[model samples]
Target chain A: MVPLSWYLALSAVLFTLGAVGVFLKRNIISMLLCLELMLNAANLAFIAFSSFFGQVEGQLFVFLVMTVAAAEAGVGLAIVIAVFRNRETLDVDESNLLKL
Target chain B: MTFEQILFILFAGIVVGGAASVLLQRNPLYSAFSLITTFVGLACLYVTLKAQFLGVVQIVVYAGAIMMLFVFVIMLLNIRDEDTAVDPNRFLVYLTIPLGAILLGALLYVVTKVNLAQPTGDEGGTVERIGTNLLTKYLLPFEATSVLILMAVVGALHLAKREKE
Candidate 1:
C-alpha cells in the first residue's frame, strides 16, 4: 500500500503547479483550469486525511467541495464569456482597465 | 513495491505530467485536453483512496459536464491558437521557481513529520455510510448545495445570454 505521505507529496506538487500556472498564464481559461487543478489537489488531501483517520465527514466534505466546484466552474466560464464579449481579449494584462 | 503502490505512482505521474502540460501548453485547447486527462487521473486516485463516490462525481461532473462547458465557451468565443497570451513580467516568471522550491520544502517538512494512526478499514468510504451521513448528518449542506447549484444555473444564463442594448 502507498503511504499517506506520498499522496500528500503529490497533492502538494499538483497544487504548486496550479499556482504557477495561475501566475504565468495570461489566458483566463487556462488560469481557471489551473484553479480546478488546485481544487482537485485539495480534494485529494481531504480524501487522504479522511482515509488516514477513518472518518466519513471528510468524504462528505469532498462531496460538498465537488458541488461547489461545479458551481464555480459554471459561473467562472460565464464570467469569462462575458468578459470576452466586452474586452475582445482574454489576456489578464490587457483586461485591466480600473488600475488606479 | 506492491501493486497498489505501483498504481498510485503511475496515476500520480499521470496527474503531475498532465498538470504540467496544462500549464506549459501554448494553446488553450491543448490545455483543456490536458486538464481532462488530469481530471481522469485525479478521479482514479480518489477511487484508489476508497472514495468511490468522489471518484464517480469527479468523472461525471468534472470530466464530463464542466469540461464540456469549458469547451463550449472556448468554441463560442472562437479562441484560436494565436489568441494565447502569456504573462510578460519577467520577475513573476522568475518568482515561480523559488515559490515552487519553498512550497516543496514546506510540503516535505510537513509530510515527513505528520503521523497518523492506522485506519480501522473502509468504514468511511462505503456508499451506505456515505448516504446515511448525507441524509442524517450532512443534510443541511446537501440541501444548500442544491440551492447553490440552482443559483449557478440562473447566474450563468443571466451572464452568458445576449444583453440587449
Candidate 2:
C-alpha cells in the first residue's frame, strides 16, 4: 500500500496551492474555482484517513461535503452572473462598490 | 517502486499539475477545464484508496454536474480573458507566499506525527453499506442536506432572475 502520509502531504500541497490561487487570481470565478480546489483537497484527506482506518464516517462526510459544494456552486455562480450583469467585468478588483 | 506507489505518483502529478494550470490560466473557462482534470485525478486516487463509491460520485457529481454548471455560466456571461487589473493591495500577494508556506509546513509536521493503525480490511465504502448508514446512523444530516439543496435552488433562482422592466 502507498503510505498514507504521502496522501496527506499531497493534500497539504493542494490546499496551499488553492490558498495562493485565491489570493493571486483577480477574477471572482477563478477565486471560486480555487475554493473548489481547497474543498477537494480536504476531501482527499478525509478519504485517506477513512481508508486507513476503515471507517465509513469519513466517506459519509465526504458525501455531505460534495452536497455542500454543489449547493455552493449553484448559489455562487448565480451571484457571479448577477455581478457580471451589473458590472460587465469579471475582475474582483473592479467590483469594489462595497470597498471604501 | 510498487505498482500502487507508481499509480499514486501518476494521479498525484495530474492533480497538482491541473491545480497549477487553474492558477496560471488567464481565462476562467480554461480554469474550469483544469479543475475538472484535478477532480478526475482525485477520483482515481479515491478508487485506489478503496472508496470506489466515492470515486464514482466524485466524477459524476463534481467533474460532470458541477463543471457543466460552471461552463454554462461562463458561456452565458460571455466572459473574456481577464485583463490585468491594477491591484489596490499588492502587499496581500507577497503576504500569501509566506502564509501558504507556513501552512504547508505546519500541516506536514502534523501529518508525520500521526501513527495510525493498519487498514482494518473492512470495506466501509460500498454503496449498500453507505446507503444503509445514511438511512440509519446519518438520517438527520441526510434529511437536512435535502432541505439545504432546496434552499440553494430557490436562492439561485431568486438571485439570477432578471427584474421586470
Candidate 3:
C-alpha cells in the first residue's frame, strides 16, 4: 500500500523546489512557471488529503485552485509580454523602470 | 509494494525531476517542455489520489490549454538560450539557498506534526457532487471566478492592444 505520507513528502519537496526557483531565477516567465509548479504541488497535497480523509471538499478545493491558477497565468503572461515588448528582455534586472 | 505503489513512485519521480529541470534549465523553451511533463505527472498523481475528474481536468486545462499558451508565448518571443543575462550576485544565491532550506525545514516540521487520521464519509467529491455544490453552496465564489476570468480577458486585450498602438 502506498502511504499518504509519501505523497505529502513528495509534494513538500516539489513545493520547495518551486520556492527555490521563484527566488533564484531572474526571468519573469521562469518565475511564473515555478509559481505554477508550487500551485500544482499544493494541489497534489489537497488531493492526497481528500483521498486519505475520504472527503470531497479537498478535491473541490483543488478544482477551484486550478481555475484560479489558469486566470492568474493568463493575466501574468499578458503582463510579461507587455514588459518584454517595451524592454526587449525578460530579465528582471534590466526592466526596473518602476525603481524610483 | 504493489503495482499501484510502483506507478505512484514512478510518477512522483517524473514530477519532481521535471520540476527540477524546469528550474535548472537555461532555455525558456526547454523549461516550458519540462513544465508540461510536470503537469502530466501531476495529473497522474491526481489519478492515484482517486480524483478522476480532477485528473482529466488537470490534463485538459493545464497540460493542453495552459502549456500551449506558454509554448506559444515562448515561440512568439523567439527567446534564444544565449539571450539570457548572467547575474553576478553570488551573495543572493547564498542567501536563497539557506532561506529555502529553512522554509523546507518548517514545512517538514509541520507535516510531521499533523496527525492525519483516515477520513470516513460520503464519497462526495465526484463531478456531480462538485457541480451541485458549486451551483448551490459555493455559488457566489463560482460566479466570482467567472467575473474574474472576464476581467482577465479584458485586461489581456488591453495589454495586447497597447503594443499595436
lDDT of 3 by residue, B28-123 (tens): 778889999998998888877778889999999998998888888878885755445336564677788788889888888777765665555546
DockQ of 3: 0.64
Better of 2 and 3 by lDDT: 2
RMSD of each: 1.5, 1.6, 1.9
lDDT per model vs. reference: 0.87, 0.91, 0.84
Best-matching candidate per TM-score: 2
When summed lDDT is taken over every stretch of 10 residues in candidate 1 chain B, the lowest stretch is: B81-90
For model 2, how does the per-residue alpha-carbon lDDT over A19-69 read when each residue is reduced to its tens digit?
999988888988999999999999999999998888889999999999999
Show where candidate 3 strays beyond 4 Å: B82-86, B117-124, B163-165
lDDT of 3 at A37: 92
TM-score of each: 0.95, 0.96, 0.93
Residue A83, candidate 3: Cα error in Å is: 0.7
lDDT of 3 at B28: 76
Q: Candidate 2 — which residues are off by over 4 angstroms?
A: B82-89
| DockQ for each model | 0.77, 0.73, 0.64
For residues B1-165, what per-residue lDDT tens digits would candidate 2 score against the true structure?
999999999999999999999998888889999999999999999999989999999999999999999999987877665343326567888888799889989999998887776466587589998999999999999999999999999999999999889
lDDT of 1 by residue, B48-128 (tens): 888887888889999999888888878778675545756465578888889888987888788877667647645558788
